[model samples]
Target: MGVNTLYFGVDFGTTNSSVAVYDGHRAWALPLDPENDLPTSLPSLLYISRENEKIVGRAAADAFIARNVDREVKTKQVDLGVSVEAYVGAEPEKSEVFNPALVDPEVRHAVRARATIEVNAPGRLFQSLKSLLRQPAFKSTEVFGTPYQLEELVSYILSPIKKAVDGCAGHAVETVVFGRPVRFSDCDDENRIAEDRLRTAAKLAGFKNVAFFLEPVGACVEYAVSVEEKQCLMVVDIGGGTCDVCIMEFQGGSGPEQRLAESRILSVAGTPVAGDALDREIIRNRIFPLLGSKARYGPSNLPMPQYIYNQILDWQNIYKFNNEEMINWLLAAEAFSNCPEGLRALRCLIQKNYGYLVAREVEAAKKRLSEVESTHITVQRDDIQIDDILVREEFSHIIEYTLGEMRECILEAEQNAGIRPSDINLVLTTGGTCLVPAIRAMLEERYGAGKLRSRDSFTSVATGLAVVARYV
Candidate 1:
């Protein structure tokens, strides 16, 4: 009997990650947990507490809020070696720098504290998720965390889908067609390094063979699968992390019978300043003010335990928050003082009371801004109140700074491919962030609206990846 062929596609996003599988004719997203019908897309976060030697996910995100730690931290911050600080609401009257070694002690204490807390309990959190991923519905033995190598996180995110497919097929799946951005980081060497890292991660994650498809190109393939006839179409993919554009010539009939005449990834643009960056900017620019004196300490002058900053950095991931818990923690900020010593105490208090709320406001704003023209983001305290509606303009301004580079990238790609903008046949868009209006407008202005095309803004790459897996 011929072995059943099952293909899995993974979109390991920066903010959220997901997996999908294709069984010859149809593509379906795989559930990470049984409760949700949608494919599994978890925040790319993992909380590790040495005291209990424990790790947690969505629930630990909640614990982060109750403790009043900042939750706007990004994976790139670790890459940049930026250190974050935490502020407390008490006073020591003198600046005292605690030893870095104290991080272990502080984390241990925090973990122990969480274990006792009912809502923020790590054990329960861990068990809940463990049960969810291991449910018979997915037929998976393990759910992995973000990979240790920053580059490998994407591949690790993809592994579960591969596992599910292999299990369903009852055989090892050897090859995959993956997605790539047309342009990555400014530094070609860095961008190349990132790609190499991803390739390595895929191999380590259990794929024996792999091929890369530009994200926009993949969207065209999926779109072409449904449409017919000769036409020049453009595909735009706005995703969580990157925005991509491709133009292609589509020919032939509907169903599985279609032909791609010519294709080029016009621009693969990303703002290191994506949704996560915007969230952090909101925390740093808006939400932090609500912490009053405790949040005022400058990174340079503040004298406090290094662990406090470590905690703040840890709390920055929005995936760490648990609803109003983050807001409540910030409400306690009135008790904090502005002096370095006072800030240390306030930081400690926040770490104990409201870390996760700060994380959530930032996260919510990011999600809101994507679909809505404006969003009201606020953090309330007796003495400190932050209430502001972040409008589309503000987001557009931030986005433009990055999109400018993308435009330049398109010019370069055009130059490299030796094709004029007019010569482009179709434009393809993909990625989650591509849904942002400002981004779409910018592409339309440059490439013309008639040339552009897009798949479901979020899942096209994974869908194309499934197609690639089938061919491999």
Candidate 2:
């Protein structure tokens, strides 16, 4: 028999990236390692630093000598070689402060040379690079001395994931499929820019031939293979950064013709509000109060700078708070603010770069709410921590607007596809956000619970794309 070589599918998700390949007879998802500790999907995150250290998530941190557990407790804050309390067993000893000022060669050199172990390690971490692509004004972001284009930053996220996939494939693979949403998150409503950035990133990340699949359509392929009857199905994909819907004409299970299922895609729609938006709802409404959003300053009792609270709400802009201008501004306000402790807390979050860390916990809590009536999450590092309970009713109220947008997207797609909610033969919901009780209730209420089906939240798109890769 000729050596079997199979095509690959890559889902470059906003919250996590996943890779899968068709190995002739079946599609297989590529995993990271011997231990399943790390999700087979890599976190869609990148951490840059002046100090040389291997950066991995909490799962892989233990295997390395100079490792920093993202959520590990720090007994004391580590700074540039002075007046710091002891951190009994904190790994990495310290975290290097990465700032935009590093763009100055002299300052960059000085920090690299003189900063302590902690001050010289993991400089700054960036998240949500995928969602920012649609912003026409967001041409580039400065990371140290270089101004990295959106595509370049995307490559930073894609590069390592490719390395893991390539290792599993055991060869230098070039051709691949990429999945994207029906609409990108942009006020300008420009999806072309978002796509071009993705293409450029894939090229930079080591792919020569590329194919694109609408995420929801790709998700439908997974359900298409499970039944022996042809069906008109709607795929509901609510991921970290976007919610996408697709009406697809699916082939019956068990035939070569099913590989050509892409031809049956009817209509697609999407909105850029899902898990990340939901997380922000919690962070802004629940967490910001603890940070100073409610605090006033000066004789006029003016509201504390709204901008400071806004920056840390999204991990993508969290680094913006670490600059001298913001820090100095906070310091000046602390002298006048009625709630200086709140301002101090804000400063601590920025200085330690805990935005992404806290977000991880918030996401966990959101997932917990879907399974139960209420749940609690804890965000902590050293002496600082925010422990709170999240009631589903409150969370649903906070995300009312997001749910509204998602409902409109589904209705629009159904209308465009010339189908009624009753017309869908099957309704397959996938993606992490799909698990939320509110999201579940919305869909079940529309189409009735009888027709609803579920797929793996993290891997469904990749699995579906792998099926699509079999033929085209």
TM-score of each: 0.63, 0.82
Off by over 4 Å in 1: 1-4, 33-37, 40-42, 49-156, 253-273, 288-350, 353-356, 370-373, 380-385, 410-427, 447-454
TM-score of 2: 0.82
Task: Give the alpha carbon lDDT tens digit for every residue of 55-138 in model 1.
Answer: 323544554344324332221111211112232222223225523333344332332211111133221112112112212232
lDDT of 1: 0.50
The candidate 1 region of ten consecutive residues with least summed lDDT is: 75-84
Clash counts for the predictions, in order: 56, 5
- How far residue 437's Cα lies from its native spot in candidate 1, in Å, is 2.4
lDDT of candidate 2 over 355-429, digit per residue (tens): 666777888898889889998878766434688899999999999998999999999899899988888988989
Candidate 1 vs. true structure, TM-score: 0.63
Q: After superposition, how far is residue 468 of candidate 2 from its true place, in Å?
A: 1.1
